[model samples]
Target: MKNPKLITKPFAQNGQKNAIPENYSSSMESNQATWDQGFGPITMIPVAAGGLPPKGQDFNGIFNQISESVVYLSMGGRFKFSADYAAAINGYPKGAILQSDDEKKEYQSIIDNNKVNFNTATQAQINAAWKLFSTDDMLQQLAGKQPAGNYLKLGDYGIGGEFPPEVIDANNVKLGGIYAPAGAAGINFYDPYAPMFVMNRNGMYIRQFQITATGKIAARDIKGEWKVYSDDEELKTRFLGINSTAVSAKQLSTKSTIAGQEFYGKGETITITPQGIGAQPVGNYLKLGDYGIGSAFPPIVADADTLGVCGFFAAAGAGSKNYFDSYTPVLVMNRDNNYRCSLQINVNGRVATRHRSGAWITYPTLDEFNAKKSLGEGQRWQDVKGSRSSGVSYTNTTGRTIALSVSTAGAIASSSIQIFVDNVLCSRNEVGGGEGTNFTRHCIGYAVIPTGSTYKVEASSIGLWAELR
Candidate 1:
């Protein structure tokens, strides 16, 4: 047995070899040389049982070694690869690490081994840990502080609500802010610069109101209690001034007088006189005792105002002689044309006079003969008989021309009548009539009278009458 300790078995393939074996060292060295020629040099480094690779080694190996050390330290001591643990190692005052399902075994091992203290932790510690592990940008966010100019501070209160304010002078009196009292309503903060208080008990605060200056309700400089109501309502008695009442047309009286003249009365009468006598009646005939001195009346004397027969005679006979004297000579006649005139009558109602001669004179009617006979006796006589007679008579002739109308009362052999004017046949009518029959005729003639001519008419029938034109 030559140096069995020096001759080692083949290195296991599980990477547990710390150093090359003596038997294979030569061959391994030659292979390494060939590999170096073909690829690169392979440096052989010694490792303790639990030590990592040294610095300046291959990065892959160095990383693996550092990872092992980290895992081992996390398992074997209070220090770990956790964020809080790393933060603590890097001089952060507080740090923490979060647990994961994959790293639970290692984390639990570290806890069980009393390598890490997880029980003595808080949100602050976790936050510190996040700050330590995160980048500078993330760390800044983890600080939980806002940048400048990012927020506002609570200011003062305003009229409707809260608002900002400022202190201007030393007294520290707030300026440019308004605070309204509870339930106090108005045009609040009426002037912000000059604050005022308006306490309206009825909650009515008009900024401005107008009052007529000429109103009877006097406004004084003194202030006192007042009651305000809607203008549409009747004013209360207490608010009404002296001598005030509701006005209406019915309240006034029409019987009132003005300027000493009576305005209203029943049945007024007025009397006027130039002489100023109240008892003097109009249309009175003034006598000597009726008027006073210096009173005047009309100068003319009317016939109705004459006093005596002389006054009547003066009014009637002022312009001519007496009427009786002018008629005295007519009572006496000197000459008479007929003293004992002989009268003769004709068949046609005419009278004639003869003067002892065999000459015959004819008067148109008896009224002419009677007038001549009265003149012979020197007597004034008036022929007054005014009618016609069947017998001839020496009297006044009353005459009328009667128009004849022929109409038959019954049937006859001949129903005819003939009309004549001045004894000459003028018209004829042969009527054939029974009931309701009628005819008409017209004629003109003359009659004699004492002083004036009279007209005469003759008719054959009694129903005939005459119309004078």
Candidate 2:
């Protein structure tokens, strides 16, 4: 048989029995032992107190001393372990032992009640163990199920609980133009789509902003330049006015010499009359009347061959100055000889005459006789003659009714004068003789005959008389 030994003792201190007996022999082996039987070799585990020491101490005491040291080590170096040793035992790392029977039973109850598998235990199974052995709060910490103070909710990541700050700034701010807030300093940012910043105060809300590109800046300036007009020489010299400078002149003729007459060209002339000169020419100084010659002039006479002729007088009355007659030497003649001569008379005014010679005689008609009777009472019985050789004669048959007188001087005769009453010959006589006798008789009568009547005179030896009605 093997010798039995007492590995541990039982003693009393602080009113609790020691786990080992006082008189226990080292060689005793009994069914009731203070220490575990068939336990593994005694090993020294050096432990430090409170905080970990620089070097740990080993225990080589009696079994009880060793057991107490083990208890102290398992108690985490505390003088008094908690009455809730099950909770204490749970605090140990996995696979550590329970110190008391109650702690073992409590730990066994936790293990039995919990469905824990060391290889397959999850945080949920460990939480079940903690609930059986420890507090609800301690179980929560053990299972890593604690609340996080700064945990982000769904989709909450960056500042503003949204996208990045820099990205938001870039999207919202105007890129290029100067930013001049109501009363702040102007910010220098240049972009094409921004407005020019006009600095204003006093809360005048000009809320507009503008931007322009470099190319657009030049274009706008050029557009403004197009609207600009300048009187300056530098600008005017570049842009000149278009107008015409050439002019044309035309010639015209006028009837006026007055100063304000519109003159189109040089050297225009006008004519003037005597009235224009305000005077007339006098004293044979070429009147328009002096140019009257030929049929337009009055008659005149000159003396010829000693014939007693008066200067040409207007034909014996207040008649035209163009009339005249001539008289010559008187002569007596026998009743039956030839006589022939030429007689001359001048016509005046618009009057004229012609003569008949060979064998023609003239007699007065009743109207002539009556017209002659209406003339002043005169001596009757005048005998006129025609040229006898020319075979004609004339006489007055107005008996005792005094006949008109005749101028026998310068009359043609031998040249018998015969007077006829009605158709009958009443008297005959002769005047001038020998061959060159020409005679003309003047029969005087009233200038007018009765209204319904007419007068005529016929001369046998010479001149014609135009009767007036």
Candidate 3:
């Protein structure tokens, strides 16, 4: 009889009426074909209608195949299928593991008595019957094995989609970016913004925080003992200004006392140095108030170098005449600071003195003064000749005051002498000669002729005419 569940074909007995030698002989062969075709890797041999029981070789063949699969499982190797497969009688139990056709990944049976060929099944069917156990790619990655290009694929770590290639080694991990690695121990993290951070065995470096980058560092306070080395030209020049030839100014602390005087504000600063005789901000300029040299008191009018005054002091030295001279006004003032007088010398060598209450008075040189005095004495007496009928006119060309005089001789009682200055009659004298005997008459006009004025003297008799300037 056939087995109820796992059926086996008929096998020959010792004595059977229908058991011929050839049929008995071929029964085992027929059953072997059926068993081999049904179970152990398919043989494709068909079973006859009344075939003998399954052969012993077929049973052994199936047992050997199961043993080989068990050996693969015990050795940490997955049972790999060459093609889609399913069992006719027995099914893979739950937890049965096998490899895919390509052997890139392994799968396990998820349901009891699963008969689905997971490699060839639809995704839904495979999900119901099998589960992915592990992947060869992930195993290679975890073992520190890189791909053909020595670059690690992110997809191997379950990351999907395309990305820039990267490398991960035993010493360092380098994510792809614009900046290249500088050393074997260097590591980098990168993104689209090109922000990269580097770390090695020596120290950590953040690209954004470097001083060369254009950004500000924000903090409440910063304290450090590190020294910075820079090669910037501007910074070097500015720092060189603090050398030996320069003044090192010290900033004053707020509300601090300096030179026995309390000062305010932190912005206040001071620079101190040796008090040389001609140093600046101290001894370079003269101080105000009373000052004297050689003696405490000197005459108001004295020769040079004998007295000193409280005023601007310039050292004596031989220089050009124009060098020591000021083209502008030089004023002398009283204690009220009002200009009492001034002394100035003109370019023509004329010295002028001025008083606060008066205008400027100029004094010529000695030669010019002598020449003018001689000219004035010569102009004191000037002679004039004229006819008795007409008047003699004299224009006062000399820049001095003058008077006119007229004398007549041989004049009758009707003869007269008259003086007119600037067309105005000033004096008239009637000359009287006794009958025919002539007598002289003098007409002295007391009229003053100003500079640039004309004076005329007329007489009826011929006589002398003169002007007193």
lDDT of each: 0.31, 0.31, 0.47
- Candidate 3 local Cα displacement, residue 41, angstroms: 99
Q: Is candidate 1 or candidate 3 better by TM-score?
A: 3
**Candidate 3 lDDT, tens digit per residue, 1-469?**
8533431222322222221121223434343333324532223334454334545554555555555555555555666533223444367778888787667888888887677665544477789988988887886667665445554355532234244223332124322222322334433221222222322232332121112233322211112122234455534333432222324344566575433335565675665343322323535543333232233342232212221233322222232122122342232333443445545564576787555535567787875664455333645554433211347575665555566656665444557777777888877777454666555444433466766788776776556655565
Tell me the tens digit of each residue's lDDT in model 2 across 2-68: 7344333222212323244334356753322333432112212223422322211111223335556
Q: List the residue pairs that clash in candidate 3.
A: 10-52, 10-53, 11-53
- TM-score winner between candidates 2 and 3: 3
Candidates ranked by TM-score: 3, 1, 2
Model 2 alpha-carbon miss at residue 386, Å:
99
Query: Candidate 1 on 144-200: residue-level lDDT in tens?
Result: 576646332354233344442322221222222333322223222222233322222
The TM-score values for the models, in the order shown, are 0.14, 0.13, 0.24
Highest TM-score: give the candidate number.
3
Cα misplacement distance, residue 154 of candidate 2 (Å)? 26
Q: Give the Cα error of residue 7 in candidate 1, in Å.
A: 38
- On a 0 to 1 TM-score scale, where does candidate 1 land against the true structure? 0.14
